[model samples]
Target: MNLDELAKKQSGSIPGYELVDYYEAAFPVYRVIVIVAILTEQNLPVVQEYILKMLDCGLNNIGDIGGFLGLSNEIIEDSLVPLTQQELVLSYLEGNSLKFSITEKGKDVMESLKVKKPTITSLPIVFDALTGSLEPHKTGLAKAKEVKDLEIPIIKPYLNKPMLEDIEFNDVRKLIKRMQKENTDIAPPPGELLDIIEVEKAWLEYKRLKVFVFYSAKEDDVMVQVFERTQRAPEYETRLLRMEREGIRVLRTVKKQSVRNGLLVENLSFNNEDLKSNEESIQEAEERVKILTKNLAEAEEEKTDQTSIHTIKRQLEEARRQLEIFQKGDRVLSTYEHRPILEQALKNAQNRVLIISPWIERGGMDDDLLALIRAALTRKVEIHIGYGISDERSSNDTYPVKKLKEYLSKSFGKYLKLHKLGNTHEKVLVCDEKFAVVTSFNWLSFKGDPNRGFRRETGLYTQNPVTIKNIIEDTLKRFNEASC
Candidate 1:
């Protein structure tokens, strides 16, 4: 039988033969041969020459099937190793030379091969527009071949067609619509061309999967270097082997995801071009929308409250009455009443712990308070201390500040910020901008001082963001001014 008749009969009835799965299994080797054979009927004797010729068939020719598959030569060869082991292709010594040719099985498989057309119809000539490789076209061909026999009205004419470089965008859209309408197994799903960000994200995902750090040294995009190594296990062959497997898996996943998303090279290129052309307009529109949104929000905020003055006065008086009553749950703490509450707030600090204690005696920076600061700092909580330490004072006020600085500098110095204030008596501590304390009781010296000698100290604690924000902001400003 002729090649066409043989393909038609055996392609249907060949036992255990699935064009899609087989083609996928045999890939680039299947692709490389088909592309080369179709481009030039003359069977090239040399494998390298054959590969190079196949490369020349397309715009990109970065040596071997790597250019076509958008992968490295090592990875492509690794994939071919399985096919070699399967005995699908024949390789034997021919007159002191290692020669390779397609076996009968390979021929049958090649005959069954079909290339899908992924031509993009662009009005403006877009040469060298697509990046990476022409893998989609090759895979599209295989998928198209597998479904060539389907009687779908929309895709019938495009069956068995060679992959095209470009076609009308609208024509592609129409074909996709028809494919959706027919609901045939053979019709490839609509594809989206990945953009710059998406392509980078895919590469990042690939590197992440491979556990390798990918650093592109090419600043202006003239040259490129791809790193496939982990710092943890540098200069090891085993790591490279793992990386190869990971690279293959990641590539396969990326390809599958891209195809599933209906991402087409031609369409993607067209989309990028469209984006580039309209980027300025898009940015301008976004800015306009932002302005309009801000205006709308301000307008809403500016709308006058309809409540009368008499009603507002009554609400204010009721709020004052509630404050006077001191609700049971009000967390306002005092050194006399809830000294432990202060320590608990310090321990619970998650994000930021700001302490504005003007006078810090050596006794005030107690073991418990210092331990809490250390623990909070270990949890990445930022600690800012605004202290009043007079140089003139003997080993009392200045001594504690000096000791605290030394202790913090040893371990948590980087996280702990010391802002020395001149003489301000503000004693407040804000934790994570949520819980706060404004107290007359000195944070460092309060607990240690004897009740008989100590002044009648009192403090107010609040868990209000507004109250905390105002206190922190005002105290921080004062602290900054004093530090200056």
Candidate 2:
């Protein structure tokens, strides 16, 4: 299901709370490497199997066995000691030479030589950073710094560095056993975790997940539900709760950041395009009704077949009904149409462009978008930007904004005006007084998050001259009201 439907379904489950907002947020995870020893089943070496076969075949002397196997006497002697210790081979002194023979135990072992036998070995084990659970050593994990898209509003890890350091051998051993029981293919079977040789290394990482945030003003409480692969992730829910108990308050922090940055907003509203489309539909229906009415009058005057007159009346009635529905139904902008509309406005604007977004970050101001802005500036189009939703400016990377400002200041500064507002959630773009867009999308801070899937962002696109003029004027008024 779509995110909106999913949110609605989740909201119904809550007693008195409503789904206030949903956003893509980061879940803290750690990648830990620990050196450990495990007792596991392994296959017997080929050389040992070959020696048993030779001894069973009555090739007893070490020199003769080595010659048959194309190995030296020293290698054969080394292979014999383990076999003899295991009671799989019998050694005796005869005629001034040591001789060997395969015992019943050795024959039995030979029958299943290809099967895995019990052995203890040392290897590196990687643990799931969040749950302190065991993960396969070769599992691919991303480093926290390497995550590029999670720029703001992070959910802090409940499991901290000190806690990672204090992870004991017994803890890892239990985790391994638990994993083994859960998934044999991932953590294999018939194995016992031995001693932890050392805690090798640990580093922070993030697991990206969709979060639905619900709040009840009456109770002054917030509920956060994390989703992975479209299902509720209880482990993450527990982690978030523990984080709250520890006074981290990640949900509150995320909500505050999202609100300040205009990432959270109410549902989309009717746009001017909706009214225009409805008007067009009503006009088309009126034309149809007129044509059908003329046909009905002609059919009756001409004394045509009763069936023809009846058909004309039916068509006219249907047209009138459709006209009524078009006049009364609510209208909305299609969710898919906003991005291209904004891009086209950016590309085609001639005289001026005004943008108001709560935050300015690199995600929205990509190289292609920068090129568009530069081209517009080169053409001497005035570009006015008003931003900053929180009283405290965002700590996100300002390199994109700074770079654009420097370029404009050096060459086309006259065409640029940058304003930091006290606080606003208005996401608008007006271009060349030709078109304007008011949206829930953060035009300067949000591009799109692929990991989070699609967000339900919608906007009104209007080419109405009066509406555009009013939007541009109001946007500039806010810009002028705020500090430059």
Candidate 3:
């Protein structure tokens, strides 16, 4: 997409900006120079060729301006219309039929354009327009090829369509990791870290899905090895191997509770507050779900009340109906995806973000940093927390922690629950409903000095761990943070 069009997309709508729009806009403008340069250098046939050639060198390969290869007098004449003049390459002769040279101001134009290339572009386009290595289809192709030789011959051709139509599946950890890598600037203070984190969040929904999903049948936009529809039985040995795999899958257990099981106690929740909107739904099916929880049915009654959540003496006496699952197994954590644990936790940390620690204090996220939270809230992202730190003994009891919590509520329009613990303990931060931010940052470090502080800071990401994505995320969440 073009610059103006992408900018309009970003400024015009807050909620409706598509993922492509976001990526395109976040992309830098200088990156476009690469595309322009390639075309111009190659003497390719395209209008961009002229634009790139002029920008790269004063001379142009095509569309003569004067005696030298530069923008022709004809192109400048076209600019008289309602064309945007924010950043342009103008080629005009000082004398009649004379030589062409770029003015200092025009050179400045090139520099400025190079610097702010994608300010007006989409975030998604940055990868393509600049980096040149975004192959979303590769993963999809890999998925299709995962299963070998087995094929169904009896099924109809019409039934072999792929399952996912959109790109960016539920792999939140992978993309979040990408963002973290993009923001590798050294930390000026904790505020810088918080700001980058918030930016990732502000645009989280935009990248909620980057991993594309394609049907097995068509080998078009996405790559796929084979797709067929049939239910033919495999050999006895094959069936035995499949059974063994299922047996191993059972060994990887996680506690997935049912709504009936009140064992789960959510540290943070909407609890029916007057808070404004957020990108995703705020209410969770249950604060703590039962282990081995499956597609349990939701109550026909709307989940409008808070006390009604855990207040129930028993599980839904009888769920309207059960969702389908091959086995009613406990939540399973994966050993292979140990790295993605933290990322998954952070990615899933929406709706209500909770940070728990024994020593809590104020000024966690600075002014510029806090503003990003408001921006996120304007986009409907909620940041909530509960920290365990008593203000009774500090120089001024409740001074630091109180100040920290207050700033969170005031600046970000988020409610941060402050819990003073009369006992010593560990640190933790739970995000949204599905993820938790368990860390070692003390309550005082909320805004304490990062260099020399009493804070024994550490933490990791955890998944209720069932899906491979979740398994990987929970591990990485902690690993990445520890590395930092």
Q: Give the TM-scores of the predictions, in the order they appear.
A: 0.30, 0.57, 0.22
Q: Give the C-alpha lDDT of model 2.
A: 0.67
> Which candidate, 1 or 2, has the higher TM-score?
2
Give the lDDT ranking, best first.
2, 1, 3
Worst 10 residues of 2 by lDDT: 256-265
Candidates' C-alpha lDDT: 0.40, 0.67, 0.29
| TM-score pick, better of 2 and 3 | 2
Cα deviation at 48, candidate 2, in Å, is 3.3
lDDT of 2 by residue, 35-102 (tens): 56676655668999999999989899999999999999999999988889878899999999899999
The stretch of ten residues in a row with the least summed lDDT in candidate 1 is: 198-207
Mind giving the per-residue lDDT tens digits that candidate 3 earns over 1-484? Answer: 3222332223322233211111100111111111100001112223333344454575532345333444465653343111123233434555554333444544554444431121111122112211222222111121112211111011111111111221122222243345445563321111111111111111100111111011121221211111111111123213223433554210111121122111122322222222221111111222223311332323224553555544342343222122111012222221112113333333444555444444433223223333443454544555433333344434223444434445556645444333333433444444454544333333223323223312212233333433323423443343333311
Most accurate candidate by TM-score: 2
Q: Residue 440 in model 2: shift from native, Å?
A: 9.3
